[model samples]
Target: MEAGEPTSLQIEKQSLHDQVASRIRDLIIEGHLEPGSRIDEAKLVEQLGVSRTPFREALRTLAAEGLIVIRPARGSMVRKLSRADVFSMLEVLAEMERLAGRTACERASDSEIAHARDLHERMLEYYRSGERMPYYKLNQEFHTFIASLSRNETLCEIQGNIMARLKRIRFIGNSEPEHWRAAVDDHEEMMDALAARDGQRLGDIMAHHLSETWQRVKNVI
Candidate 1:
Protein backbone atom coordinates (compact mmCIF):
# COMPACT_ATOMS: atom_id res chain seq x y z
CA MET A 1 0.00 0.00 0.00
CA GLU A 2 1.15 3.50 -0.73
CA ALA A 3 2.12 5.66 2.23
CA GLY A 4 -0.86 7.80 3.45
CA GLU A 5 -3.27 5.48 1.64
CA PRO A 6 -6.58 5.04 3.40
CA THR A 7 -7.32 1.51 4.57
CA SER A 8 -10.61 -0.21 3.65
CA LEU A 9 -12.04 0.46 7.09
CA GLN A 10 -11.21 4.11 6.72
CA ILE A 11 -12.97 4.17 3.36
CA GLU A 12 -16.05 2.58 4.88
CA LYS A 13 -16.04 5.16 7.65
CA GLN A 14 -15.87 7.99 5.14
CA SER A 15 -18.70 6.44 3.18
CA LEU A 16 -20.77 6.22 6.33
CA HIS A 17 -20.02 9.86 7.02
CA ASP A 18 -21.23 10.84 3.55
CA GLN A 19 -24.37 8.75 3.89
CA VAL A 20 -25.09 10.45 7.17
CA ALA A 21 -24.55 13.82 5.60
CA SER A 22 -26.86 12.99 2.71
CA ARG A 23 -29.60 11.89 5.05
CA ILE A 24 -29.34 15.12 6.96
CA ARG A 25 -29.30 17.12 3.75
CA ASP A 26 -32.51 15.49 2.60
CA LEU A 27 -34.11 16.21 5.98
CA ILE A 28 -33.38 19.89 5.61
CA ILE A 29 -34.41 20.07 1.96
CA GLU A 30 -37.60 18.10 2.45
CA GLY A 31 -38.74 20.26 5.35
CA HIS A 32 -38.55 17.42 7.82
CA LEU A 33 -36.08 19.53 9.80
CA GLU A 34 -37.56 22.97 9.38
CA PRO A 35 -35.37 25.96 8.82
CA GLY A 36 -34.05 27.85 11.85
CA SER A 37 -34.72 24.92 14.13
CA ARG A 38 -31.84 23.75 16.28
CA ILE A 39 -30.56 20.31 15.42
CA ASP A 40 -31.12 18.03 18.38
CA GLU A 41 -27.97 16.04 17.82
CA ALA A 42 -28.42 13.50 20.57
CA LYS A 43 -31.96 12.67 19.51
CA LEU A 44 -31.02 12.42 15.84
CA VAL A 45 -28.00 10.29 16.61
CA GLU A 46 -30.15 7.83 18.47
CA GLN A 47 -32.81 7.87 15.80
CA LEU A 48 -30.26 7.21 13.09
CA GLY A 49 -28.59 4.55 15.24
CA VAL A 50 -25.25 6.17 14.64
CA SER A 51 -22.69 7.46 17.10
CA ARG A 52 -21.94 11.08 17.94
CA THR A 53 -18.83 11.18 15.78
CA PRO A 54 -20.59 10.56 12.48
CA PHE A 55 -23.50 12.79 13.42
CA ARG A 56 -21.21 15.68 14.31
CA GLU A 57 -19.16 15.02 11.21
CA ALA A 58 -22.35 15.19 9.15
CA LEU A 59 -23.14 18.54 10.74
CA ARG A 60 -19.78 19.89 9.68
CA THR A 61 -20.40 18.65 6.13
CA LEU A 62 -23.79 20.37 6.00
CA ALA A 63 -22.32 23.52 7.50
CA ALA A 64 -19.83 23.64 4.66
CA GLU A 65 -22.68 23.12 2.23
CA GLY A 66 -24.46 26.19 3.67
CA LEU A 67 -27.39 24.15 4.86
CA ILE A 68 -26.68 24.74 8.55
CA VAL A 69 -24.97 27.27 10.79
CA ILE A 70 -22.71 26.07 13.58
CA ARG A 71 -22.17 28.45 16.43
CA PRO A 72 -19.31 28.28 18.90
CA ALA A 73 -21.43 27.79 21.98
CA ARG A 74 -24.96 27.71 20.62
CA GLY A 75 -24.72 24.38 18.82
CA SER A 76 -26.17 24.29 15.28
CA MET A 77 -29.35 25.40 13.59
CA VAL A 78 -30.74 25.11 10.10
CA ARG A 79 -29.71 28.06 7.96
CA LYS A 80 -32.87 29.94 7.17
CA LEU A 81 -32.72 32.39 4.34
CA SER A 82 -34.81 35.44 5.07
CA ARG A 83 -37.16 36.68 2.37
CA ALA A 84 -34.64 39.32 1.43
CA ASP A 85 -31.84 36.80 1.28
CA VAL A 86 -33.98 34.54 -0.87
CA PHE A 87 -34.58 37.34 -3.31
CA SER A 88 -30.92 38.27 -3.48
CA MET A 89 -29.65 34.73 -4.02
CA LEU A 90 -32.31 33.85 -6.54
CA GLU A 91 -31.50 37.04 -8.44
CA VAL A 92 -27.91 35.96 -8.79
CA LEU A 93 -28.94 32.44 -9.78
CA ALA A 94 -31.34 33.78 -12.37
CA GLU A 95 -28.63 35.93 -13.94
CA MET A 96 -26.20 33.04 -14.04
CA GLU A 97 -28.71 30.68 -15.62
CA ARG A 98 -29.57 33.35 -18.15
CA LEU A 99 -25.94 33.54 -19.18
CA ALA A 100 -25.63 29.77 -19.20
CA GLY A 101 -28.68 29.44 -21.38
CA ARG A 102 -27.17 31.84 -23.88
CA THR A 103 -23.77 30.26 -23.76
CA ALA A 104 -25.14 26.72 -23.99
CA CYS A 105 -27.06 27.56 -27.09
CA GLU A 106 -23.82 28.64 -28.66
CA ARG A 107 -21.64 25.88 -27.26
CA ALA A 108 -23.47 22.62 -26.62
CA SER A 109 -23.11 19.83 -29.16
CA ASP A 110 -26.21 18.28 -30.73
CA SER A 111 -25.86 15.13 -28.66
CA GLU A 112 -25.52 17.13 -25.48
CA ILE A 113 -28.63 19.12 -26.27
CA ALA A 114 -30.49 15.91 -26.97
CA HIS A 115 -29.33 14.51 -23.67
CA ALA A 116 -30.84 17.48 -21.87
CA ARG A 117 -34.05 16.87 -23.73
CA ASP A 118 -34.00 13.31 -22.44
CA LEU A 119 -33.58 14.50 -18.87
CA HIS A 120 -36.57 16.80 -19.23
CA GLU A 121 -38.63 13.91 -20.51
CA ARG A 122 -37.77 11.82 -17.48
CA MET A 123 -38.58 14.69 -15.13
CA LEU A 124 -41.96 15.13 -16.80
CA GLU A 125 -42.76 11.50 -16.22
CA TYR A 126 -42.16 11.97 -12.47
CA TYR A 127 -44.39 15.03 -12.58
CA ARG A 128 -47.11 13.03 -14.27
CA SER A 129 -46.98 10.50 -11.46
CA GLY A 130 -47.31 13.35 -8.92
CA GLU A 131 -44.03 12.42 -7.27
CA ARG A 132 -42.84 15.72 -5.86
CA MET A 133 -39.41 14.79 -4.61
CA PRO A 134 -38.49 12.76 -7.66
CA TYR A 135 -39.69 15.58 -9.86
CA TYR A 136 -37.65 18.09 -7.91
CA LYS A 137 -34.58 15.91 -8.12
CA LEU A 138 -34.79 15.86 -11.88
CA ASN A 139 -35.63 19.51 -11.95
CA GLN A 140 -32.47 20.27 -10.02
CA GLU A 141 -30.43 17.99 -12.24
CA PHE A 142 -31.80 19.62 -15.39
CA HIS A 143 -30.86 23.07 -14.22
CA THR A 144 -27.36 21.98 -13.25
CA PHE A 145 -26.93 20.19 -16.55
CA ILE A 146 -27.85 23.33 -18.44
CA ALA A 147 -25.32 25.31 -16.47
CA SER A 148 -22.65 22.73 -17.17
CA LEU A 149 -23.42 22.98 -20.86
CA SER A 150 -21.89 26.41 -20.73
CA ARG A 151 -18.54 24.53 -20.54
CA ASN A 152 -17.19 27.24 -18.28
CA GLU A 153 -15.94 25.74 -15.03
CA THR A 154 -15.92 29.03 -13.11
CA LEU A 155 -19.51 29.83 -13.94
CA CYS A 156 -20.66 26.36 -12.92
CA GLU A 157 -18.65 26.52 -9.67
CA ILE A 158 -20.13 29.85 -8.62
CA GLN A 159 -23.64 28.76 -9.57
CA GLY A 160 -23.26 25.53 -7.60
CA ASN A 161 -22.15 27.39 -4.46
CA ILE A 162 -25.15 29.68 -4.55
CA MET A 163 -27.44 26.76 -5.29
CA ALA A 164 -26.23 24.83 -2.23
CA ARG A 165 -27.78 27.54 -0.07
CA LEU A 166 -30.98 27.81 -2.09
CA LYS A 167 -31.75 24.10 -2.35
CA ARG A 168 -34.58 24.11 0.14
CA ILE A 169 -36.07 27.30 -1.22
CA ARG A 170 -36.23 25.89 -4.71
CA PHE A 171 -37.58 22.58 -3.50
CA ILE A 172 -40.37 24.19 -1.53
CA GLY A 173 -41.21 26.68 -4.23
CA ASN A 174 -43.14 24.08 -6.20
CA SER A 175 -45.23 22.83 -3.32
CA GLU A 176 -48.38 24.17 -4.93
CA PRO A 177 -49.86 22.63 -8.04
CA GLU A 178 -50.07 25.97 -9.75
CA HIS A 179 -46.46 26.83 -9.02
CA TRP A 180 -45.27 23.46 -10.25
CA ARG A 181 -47.22 23.80 -13.47
CA ALA A 182 -45.85 27.28 -14.02
CA ALA A 183 -42.33 26.01 -13.52
CA VAL A 184 -42.91 23.16 -15.95
CA ASP A 185 -44.28 25.50 -18.53
CA ASP A 186 -41.18 27.63 -18.24
CA HIS A 187 -39.02 24.54 -18.71
CA GLU A 188 -40.96 23.48 -21.77
CA GLU A 189 -40.29 26.81 -23.40
CA MET A 190 -36.68 26.66 -22.37
CA MET A 191 -36.32 23.34 -24.18
CA ASP A 192 -37.86 24.83 -27.29
CA ALA A 193 -35.48 27.77 -27.21
CA LEU A 194 -32.51 25.53 -26.73
CA ALA A 195 -33.49 23.25 -29.58
CA ALA A 196 -33.90 26.24 -31.84
CA ARG A 197 -30.48 27.45 -30.76
CA ASP A 198 -32.11 30.70 -29.79
CA GLY A 199 -29.89 31.97 -27.04
CA GLN A 200 -31.78 35.22 -26.54
CA ARG A 201 -35.10 33.48 -26.07
CA LEU A 202 -33.68 30.82 -23.80
CA GLY A 203 -31.92 33.42 -21.67
CA ASP A 204 -35.16 35.36 -21.16
CA ILE A 205 -37.09 32.24 -20.26
CA MET A 206 -34.46 31.02 -17.79
CA ALA A 207 -34.33 34.38 -16.07
CA HIS A 208 -38.09 34.59 -15.79
CA HIS A 209 -38.25 31.03 -14.50
CA LEU A 210 -36.07 31.73 -11.47
CA SER A 211 -37.62 35.13 -10.84
CA GLU A 212 -41.01 33.47 -10.39
CA THR A 213 -39.61 31.33 -7.57
CA TRP A 214 -39.75 34.31 -5.22
CA GLN A 215 -43.51 34.48 -5.55
CA ARG A 216 -43.89 30.78 -4.86
CA VAL A 217 -41.78 30.72 -1.72
CA LYS A 218 -42.05 34.16 -0.18
CA ASN A 219 -43.56 33.03 3.11
CA VAL A 220 -41.30 30.07 3.86
CA ILE A 221 -39.08 31.99 6.24
Candidate 2:
Protein backbone atom coordinates (compact mmCIF):
# COMPACT_ATOMS: atom_id res chain seq x y z
CA MET A 1 0.00 0.00 0.00
CA GLU A 2 1.19 3.51 -0.77
CA ALA A 3 1.55 6.20 1.86
CA GLY A 4 -1.81 7.84 2.63
CA GLU A 5 -3.53 4.80 1.17
CA PRO A 6 -5.87 2.79 3.42
CA THR A 7 -5.20 -0.93 3.11
CA SER A 8 -8.33 -3.11 2.96
CA LEU A 9 -7.24 -4.91 6.08
CA GLN A 10 -6.62 -1.67 7.91
CA ILE A 11 -10.05 -0.27 7.02
CA GLU A 12 -11.74 -3.51 7.98
CA LYS A 13 -10.01 -3.65 11.31
CA GLN A 14 -10.78 -0.03 12.07
CA SER A 15 -14.52 -0.61 11.74
CA LEU A 16 -14.57 -4.19 12.98
CA HIS A 17 -15.84 -3.31 16.44
CA ASP A 18 -18.78 -1.31 15.11
CA GLN A 19 -19.56 -4.08 12.66
CA VAL A 20 -19.49 -6.65 15.44
CA ALA A 21 -21.77 -4.55 17.59
CA SER A 22 -24.29 -4.08 14.80
CA ARG A 23 -24.31 -7.80 14.00
CA ILE A 24 -24.90 -8.68 17.62
CA ARG A 25 -27.70 -6.14 17.91
CA ASP A 26 -29.35 -7.53 14.78
CA LEU A 27 -29.15 -11.05 16.13
CA ILE A 28 -30.71 -9.99 19.37
CA ILE A 29 -33.53 -8.06 17.69
CA GLU A 30 -34.22 -10.94 15.26
CA GLY A 31 -34.59 -13.47 18.08
CA HIS A 32 -31.54 -15.37 16.84
CA LEU A 33 -30.20 -14.68 20.28
CA GLU A 34 -33.04 -16.01 22.39
CA PRO A 35 -34.05 -14.31 25.59
CA GLY A 36 -31.90 -15.33 28.56
CA SER A 37 -29.44 -17.19 26.36
CA ARG A 38 -25.93 -16.83 27.64
CA ILE A 39 -23.68 -14.86 25.34
CA ASP A 40 -20.40 -16.72 24.95
CA GLU A 41 -18.03 -13.78 24.85
CA ALA A 42 -14.96 -15.88 24.12
CA LYS A 43 -16.54 -17.49 21.07
CA LEU A 44 -18.06 -14.19 19.94
CA VAL A 45 -14.69 -12.48 20.23
CA GLU A 46 -13.11 -15.20 18.16
CA GLN A 47 -15.88 -15.12 15.58
CA LEU A 48 -15.85 -11.31 15.36
CA GLY A 49 -12.00 -11.22 15.15
CA VAL A 50 -11.73 -8.50 17.75
CA SER A 51 -9.98 -8.37 21.11
CA ARG A 52 -11.66 -8.44 24.52
CA THR A 53 -11.78 -4.66 24.68
CA PRO A 54 -14.22 -4.15 21.81
CA PHE A 55 -16.20 -7.26 22.63
CA ARG A 56 -16.68 -6.08 26.20
CA GLU A 57 -17.49 -2.62 24.99
CA ALA A 58 -20.28 -3.98 22.80
CA LEU A 59 -21.63 -6.02 25.69
CA ARG A 60 -21.67 -2.98 27.93
CA THR A 61 -23.47 -0.96 25.32
CA LEU A 62 -26.19 -3.56 24.87
CA ALA A 63 -26.55 -3.90 28.62
CA ALA A 64 -27.04 -0.18 28.94
CA GLU A 65 -29.83 -0.39 26.38
CA GLY A 66 -31.69 -3.00 28.47
CA LEU A 67 -31.19 -5.59 25.79
CA ILE A 68 -28.76 -7.67 27.84
CA VAL A 69 -28.22 -8.52 31.45
CA ILE A 70 -24.73 -8.85 32.85
CA ARG A 71 -24.54 -11.10 35.88
CA PRO A 72 -21.70 -11.55 38.27
CA ALA A 73 -20.75 -15.10 37.27
CA ARG A 74 -23.18 -16.02 34.51
CA GLY A 75 -21.70 -13.38 32.24
CA SER A 76 -24.10 -11.76 29.76
CA MET A 77 -27.56 -12.98 28.75
CA VAL A 78 -30.24 -11.58 26.51
CA ARG A 79 -32.95 -9.77 28.43
CA LYS A 80 -36.12 -11.79 28.82
CA LEU A 81 -39.46 -10.14 28.14
CA SER A 82 -42.51 -11.09 30.09
CA ARG A 83 -46.08 -10.35 29.10
CA ALA A 84 -46.00 -7.31 31.33
CA ASP A 85 -42.87 -6.06 29.63
CA VAL A 86 -44.47 -6.46 26.24
CA PHE A 87 -47.65 -4.67 27.25
CA SER A 88 -45.81 -1.88 29.03
CA MET A 89 -43.55 -1.25 26.07
CA LEU A 90 -46.46 -1.30 23.65
CA GLU A 91 -48.42 1.12 25.78
CA VAL A 92 -45.52 3.52 25.99
CA LEU A 93 -44.87 3.34 22.26
CA ALA A 94 -48.54 3.83 21.48
CA GLU A 95 -48.58 7.05 23.46
CA MET A 96 -45.37 8.27 21.90
CA GLU A 97 -46.64 7.52 18.44
CA ARG A 98 -49.91 9.28 19.25
CA LEU A 99 -47.96 12.34 20.31
CA ALA A 100 -45.97 12.22 17.10
CA GLY A 101 -49.04 11.78 14.95
CA ARG A 102 -50.85 14.67 16.60
CA THR A 103 -47.83 16.91 16.30
CA ALA A 104 -47.34 15.90 12.68
CA CYS A 105 -50.96 16.76 11.89
CA GLU A 106 -50.38 20.30 13.14
CA ARG A 107 -46.78 20.81 12.03
CA ALA A 108 -46.32 18.92 8.76
CA SER A 109 -46.33 21.16 5.73
CA ASP A 110 -48.52 20.36 2.72
CA SER A 111 -45.52 19.01 0.81
CA GLU A 112 -44.57 16.70 3.67
CA ILE A 113 -48.08 15.28 3.86
CA ALA A 114 -48.09 14.76 0.13
CA HIS A 115 -44.77 12.97 0.30
CA ALA A 116 -46.16 10.61 2.91
CA ARG A 117 -49.21 9.98 0.76
CA ASP A 118 -46.98 9.20 -2.21
CA LEU A 119 -44.92 6.81 -0.15
CA HIS A 120 -48.06 5.06 1.02
CA GLU A 121 -49.24 4.66 -2.54
CA ARG A 122 -45.84 3.33 -3.58
CA MET A 123 -45.89 0.93 -0.64
CA LEU A 124 -49.24 -0.41 -1.79
CA GLU A 125 -47.83 -0.89 -5.27
CA TYR A 126 -44.88 -2.76 -3.86
CA TYR A 127 -47.25 -4.94 -1.87
CA ARG A 128 -49.25 -5.71 -4.97
CA SER A 129 -46.06 -6.62 -6.79
CA GLY A 130 -45.48 -9.34 -4.18
CA GLU A 131 -42.01 -8.07 -3.32
CA ARG A 132 -42.01 -8.25 0.45
CA MET A 133 -38.64 -6.58 0.95
CA PRO A 134 -39.48 -3.43 -0.99
CA TYR A 135 -42.86 -3.18 0.64
CA TYR A 136 -41.35 -3.45 4.09
CA LYS A 137 -38.71 -0.83 3.32
CA LEU A 138 -41.35 1.60 2.08
CA ASN A 139 -43.49 0.90 5.11
CA GLN A 140 -40.60 1.89 7.36
CA GLU A 141 -40.06 5.03 5.34
CA PHE A 142 -43.70 5.97 5.63
CA HIS A 143 -43.67 5.79 9.39
CA THR A 144 -40.30 7.50 9.64
CA PHE A 145 -41.45 10.41 7.51
CA ILE A 146 -44.40 11.00 9.80
CA ALA A 147 -42.11 10.83 12.81
CA SER A 148 -39.72 13.29 11.25
CA LEU A 149 -42.54 15.71 10.61
CA SER A 150 -43.38 15.75 14.31
CA ARG A 151 -40.16 17.74 14.90
CA ASN A 152 -39.77 16.32 18.38
CA GLU A 153 -36.31 14.91 18.72
CA THR A 154 -37.04 13.15 21.99
CA LEU A 155 -40.18 11.49 20.66
CA CYS A 156 -38.30 10.40 17.53
CA GLU A 157 -35.59 8.77 19.63
CA ILE A 158 -38.13 6.96 21.79
CA GLN A 159 -40.10 5.76 18.79
CA GLY A 160 -36.91 4.40 17.24
CA ASN A 161 -36.09 2.39 20.34
CA ILE A 162 -39.62 1.02 20.54
CA MET A 163 -39.62 0.06 16.87
CA ALA A 164 -36.28 -1.67 17.15
CA ARG A 165 -37.60 -3.90 19.92
CA LEU A 166 -40.79 -4.67 18.00
CA LYS A 167 -39.18 -5.36 14.61
CA ARG A 168 -38.88 -9.12 15.12
CA ILE A 169 -42.48 -9.54 16.19
CA ARG A 170 -43.59 -7.28 13.34
CA PHE A 171 -41.86 -9.60 10.88
CA ILE A 172 -43.87 -12.50 12.19
CA GLY A 173 -47.16 -10.62 11.95
CA ASN A 174 -46.37 -9.43 8.43
CA SER A 175 -46.20 -13.03 7.32
CA GLU A 176 -49.97 -13.22 7.61
CA PRO A 177 -51.85 -11.72 4.70
CA GLU A 178 -54.74 -10.57 6.87
CA HIS A 179 -52.39 -8.67 9.15
CA TRP A 180 -50.61 -7.14 6.17
CA ARG A 181 -53.82 -5.79 4.71
CA ALA A 182 -54.94 -4.48 8.05
CA ALA A 183 -51.59 -2.76 8.52
CA VAL A 184 -51.98 -1.04 5.14
CA ASP A 185 -55.45 0.12 6.01
CA ASP A 186 -54.20 1.44 9.32
CA HIS A 187 -51.54 3.44 7.55
CA GLU A 188 -54.12 4.89 5.25
CA GLU A 189 -56.30 5.96 8.13
CA MET A 190 -53.32 7.52 9.83
CA MET A 191 -52.51 9.44 6.69
CA ASP A 192 -56.07 10.64 6.36
CA ALA A 193 -56.11 11.89 9.92
CA LEU A 194 -52.85 13.73 9.38
CA ALA A 195 -54.03 15.31 6.14
CA ALA A 196 -57.14 16.65 7.86
CA ARG A 197 -55.07 18.00 10.75
CA ASP A 198 -57.30 16.19 13.18
CA GLY A 199 -55.05 16.04 16.20
CA GLN A 200 -57.47 14.36 18.62
CA ARG A 201 -58.63 11.84 16.04
CA LEU A 202 -55.04 11.13 15.06
CA GLY A 203 -54.08 10.48 18.66
CA ASP A 204 -56.95 8.08 19.18
CA ILE A 205 -56.28 6.32 15.90
CA MET A 206 -52.58 6.00 16.57
CA ALA A 207 -53.10 4.53 20.01
CA HIS A 208 -55.68 2.04 18.84
CA HIS A 209 -53.64 1.15 15.79
CA LEU A 210 -50.62 0.25 17.88
CA SER A 211 -52.76 -1.57 20.39
CA GLU A 212 -54.20 -3.74 17.63
CA THR A 213 -50.74 -4.50 16.36
CA TRP A 214 -49.60 -5.59 19.79
CA GLN A 215 -52.63 -7.81 20.14
CA ARG A 216 -51.90 -9.49 16.84
CA VAL A 217 -48.19 -10.03 17.46
CA LYS A 218 -48.12 -10.79 21.18
CA ASN A 219 -49.12 -14.40 20.72
CA VAL A 220 -46.37 -14.99 18.23
CA ILE A 221 -43.84 -13.48 20.56
What does candidate 1 score on TM? 0.90
Instruction: TM-score each candidate.
Output: 0.90, 0.73
Winning candidate number (TM-score) = 1
Q: Write the per-residue lDDT of candidate 1 for residues 5-46, one digit (tens) a residue.
A: 222212234437787887788778887788998998876775
Residue 90's lDDT within candidate 1 is 93
In terms of lDDT, model 2 sits at 0.76
Residue range 1-221, candidate 2, lDDT tens digits: 22432223222463455666666776675566777789888766755667888778888777766778889877999887776777888899889878888899989999998998899889989878876657866776777678888999988888877776555555556778888888878888887898899977887887887788778878766
